[model samples]
Target: MNQIDTGLVKRLIGEQFPEWAHLEVKPVKFSGHDNRTFHLGDKMSVRLPSDAAYAPQVEKENKWLPILSKELSLPISTPIAKGNPSEAYPWPWSINKWIEGETVTKQNVRDLSKFAAHLGSFLVELQSIDASKGPIAGAHNFYRGGLISVYDEEARDAIENNKDVFDETVLKHLWDLALQSTWRRKPVWIHGDVAPGNLLVKDGKLCAVIDFGILGVGDPACDAAMSWTFFDKSSRKIFKEVLQIDEETWNRARGWVLWKALITYDANKISNKIVAEESYRVIQVIVNDYGR
Candidate 1:
């Protein structure tokens, strides 16, 4: 996909949403792989999916974020206007009420354990919402909230291919543990992607969560997977305790984290050095914790 620059964004907004076209369109500092986000003046954000695969999330977020926001304790991205495809931009896009906070990272947090508890509380509340009609786990969400076994073949392939970097025996053990349990309970709402980039911090506290592009209803274990990616041993303990996650769920969460890290590290090791390194670090965390 071609990079979405400020000029493209400005032209799209000017064509589709003439009212807001007059507002300054500046590129946001941290745009993710799935979408290009730009700040529209001081109050709104413009988000355009980088490709067709991610385009569907525009409608999904538009349709569900308002509903989810009402139920969630923390602030969420609220779509203000939906943009249609034009000559300049082909994919559907969204204008959201700009959230005022910095994306949370490990270094910026004042207290890891407390932050974990805050995040855990938010997830508990989100899961408690009525998700009877929410979207089910499937390809739309990259099979998140679905069975971890869905990625078993791919994970095994990654393990085998990366034998020089990982221990085949230990990776197999972790994979087996993840496959041993299924989500026996009723499905619940899961945030699908809960990495630090999706979390916002203000006043040294977790203030809001954004990017519900992968939101769905299914095994809550997917949300629990962030415990490994974002928290340390002490903070992870607090996170599990606050959420009251069971042993089976925690094991499955480890599987989810391992699967993502393994595939991500393998796929991007040479092409994208930064993500590869980060994914490698997460893999190490999972292995070290599992070993203990």
Candidate 2:
């Protein structure tokens, strides 16, 4: 894979978009996991997929974001121009109008419950969009809205490997409970990756949403996974009230959270203490919730 840095971005611009090549190119402070983002002058930003796996997102965002933005009240990353593959980069990239805000964090948010309400409303509006032509969940999204059971093997493996560290019996019980229910209604659009890194905060509120690499129409349960890791009990309640999703769907969402936490802990158990501990904490959150 080619290095996704400012120098490469400058070259891509100078080659493909010479009209704006004179503007300086610099790296954004918090570029996300799927795409490497850089500042293109002061008003626009350049975003390139870090791997072929994310290449399809360029087209998806170009097609849907503008449509979604018009109906959505908050700001979204809408593409201005798309750059084709060049000698330096293998996949397509995008230049987008910059959205000004800070990445969301619990510390920066003024009121967790209020922020949750605002976020919940945004999600409700997103789901309300017409999905008659939207992409369905599959490989491009790592099956984010497909089925949590697709990850059953991975989660069970993690449980087996970490028996000494975690209560395997408790985890298995929760896993069974999670898989017992599944989505049985009409599908809706989902922001496949709803983590904090994809959310933007301004004035201590969720002001904008970026990074739509996993946007698609599918089971909405995956979008609710954050309820466990990102929100407190009260705030989670507020968010749940807005979605009005069924209890069975919420169960599958718990399975979604559990799968990610399990693999994450298994992978980093020996390499990074902080990440390993945090993953364990997320798992414990699910376990405690299940006991209720």
Best by TM-score: 2
Q: In model 1, which range of ten residues has the least summed lDDT?
A: 1-10
Which regions in candidate 2 have their CA more than 4 angstroms from the true location?
none
Residue pairs whose backbone atoms clash in candidate 1: none
TM-score of 2: 0.97
Misplaced by over 4 Å in model 1 are 1-3
Q: TM-score for each prediction?
A: 0.96, 0.97
Write candidate 2's Cα lDDT for 22-140 as tens digits: 99999999988889999998999999998889999999999999999999999999899999998899899999999999999889999999988998899999999998789988998
**What is the Å distance of residue 256 in model 2 from its true position?**
0.6
Candidate 1 global lDDT = 0.90
